[model samples]
Target: MGRKKKKFILGIDLGGTKILMGLFDRKFGLKKTVKLEMDGNRGEKFFFNKLIDGIEEVLEETGSDLSDLVTIGIGCPGIIDIYTGTVKVSSNVSFFKNYPLAEKLKAKLRVPVFIENDANAALFGEQQFGAARGHGEVVGVFLGTGIGGALIINGHLYRGVSGGAGEIGQTFLSIPSVSDFETTRLKVGALVGRNAIASEAGFLLLRQKCPHLLEEIGYNVKKIRSGALSRAIRAGDTALEDLIRSRSRWLGVALANVVNVLNPELVLLGGGMMEAMGKIILPEVRSGIEACALKPLMKALKVVPSRLKDNAVILGASKMACEILKMTQK
Candidate 1:
């Protein structure tokens, strides 16, 4: 008998500001990666064209072609309908409202495609191959342009009713002061998301607190990403440090609320900010958790930074593609 031909899987991490794609062998070995910037402009056609071109570019570089692919998987931001592979509402992705991403990609690529909420895919990746390994229950929170969250219970990804079970970002930390006595609300995303952090930095800049940071991002608040902020903090921006600590306090309190309710085996803190400033922020977050989490639960619960860095979503997405392929074969 002749040796069987090899197949590959493609995993994409579609974020608000970037698109990352990885090609993996059948054994899940990462063969190549391609990165593309997404400023979230030029509309849907622009996004789709770049996506397809990026895929083709990666394959061409790896000495392979589309016919060698087994399946494709995507971990995208926002509320996703996993069954239909549609993105219901993506605030970070303005053009992805009710987007049939999987169906559209499948039609174009002529291959099986699966989609999952980015945070869910990231948590699954960590569980299978990264920090949360061997932990059957976990809560993962990602702080970025917006917050993303997911839950895993008994070694399985838990998507609650309507696939919105673990949207910790949407939870509220304060009551709004309505002008007319009507009800109002503010979500944790607005309170601690990256944009909020940048706004605080902007406030400091207006006050002339961190001039060094001013040179880094100029006057553009949008230019102050997590990495740049981290650099400023490291350069003795104690004022910026204090500001971040305050925001981390809010996140810590919210995480405490989540832990008090769910009490998972571990809590994972990730995303751009966490990736860059984990050491600076984790202490305050733990302090917040200590203030509110149940005493007994605290004794058993573990919280730590994610180990996979930027690769979690892609790895998880590719593994999901492998699983889907197995199911189809059966």
Candidate 2:
């Protein structure tokens, strides 16, 4: 009798500022990982090259080759055409408009490739192995450079027509103005995303003449990331904390609306911003939901942070890849 060969899949989570790749066995155990900075401003060639480099590095580190891989899955921060493996448009990475990423990767590696929106992947990961395990209805909202959302209904991913269903960040809200009868409307992303927090913090620091933060990050708005912002808060930057709380409350309101509409069984929050500042932000989010969401819905809903942390997307991608492989075999 011959020994059974090991099967593995490559799962890649491509974010706005970082690219994470993991090699996983058939049971979804991570065997190796590679992380690289993603420069979205650099254009498609640079991005593609970096992705290829990361994959090769992981394969080399794990003592594996393309022939040993079963399939490749990518979770990208963009609007994906899942049926065709094309990226219709990506707000975070502007160069990927109408890009046939799956076809390109398949042609290069001679392996089946699957691509999905990052938030959706994360949700799947959570449902399969993380916080939302065993839940049939789940909604995942990831707070990063921009907020991303995904929906799982009746144990299946709910990708709407055109694969653009879970765009919670783009949902707008109208608030009545104090000075007039008119109401002001704003996109949820503009009010609660990481960029908004960073912008507000930058303005506060500048106005308060706080040189420490500017000095720490070379006074570059682009460089003011979640870690920097968290450090600032930990250093007793009251203004920054206040700004984050205010924005997080609005995020909660946005999520409250989602909970009301979807009536999901579980709501999972993840991404860099949440991972870094969840302790500070989650309370406000909970409060906002309590204030706005239907009482019965709130009673049944479980709002929790992602247990898988940073690996949620990659694991989800791996699961998707494995499922695709099974389908092909069948």
Clashes of each: 0, 0
Residue by residue across 173-272, what tens digits does model 2's lDDT show? 6654664323223678777888877777777666864455666785677878888888877877777778888888888888899899999988888999
Q: After superposition, how far is residue 20 of candidate 2 from its true place, in Å?
A: 0.6
RMSD of 2: 3.3
C-alpha lDDT values of all predictions: 0.87, 0.86
TM-score of each: 0.95, 0.93
Range of the 10 consecutive residues with the lowest summed lDDT in candidate 2: 176-185
lDDT of 1 by residue, 1-330 (tens): 975475899999998788999999988889999999885667888888899999999999999988888889899988889879999988767778888989999999998899998899899899889999999889999888888999998889998888876888788787666553222226788778888889889999889898889889888988889988999999988899998898888888999998988888899988889998999788888888989899998998888999887888999988977787788789
What residue runs in model 1 are displaced by over 4 Å at the alpha carbon? 1-4, 177-185
Q: How much is 41 displaced in model 2, in angstroms?
A: 3.0
Best by lDDT: 1
Model 2: residues >4 Å from true position, as ranges? Answer: 1-6, 175-185, 209-212
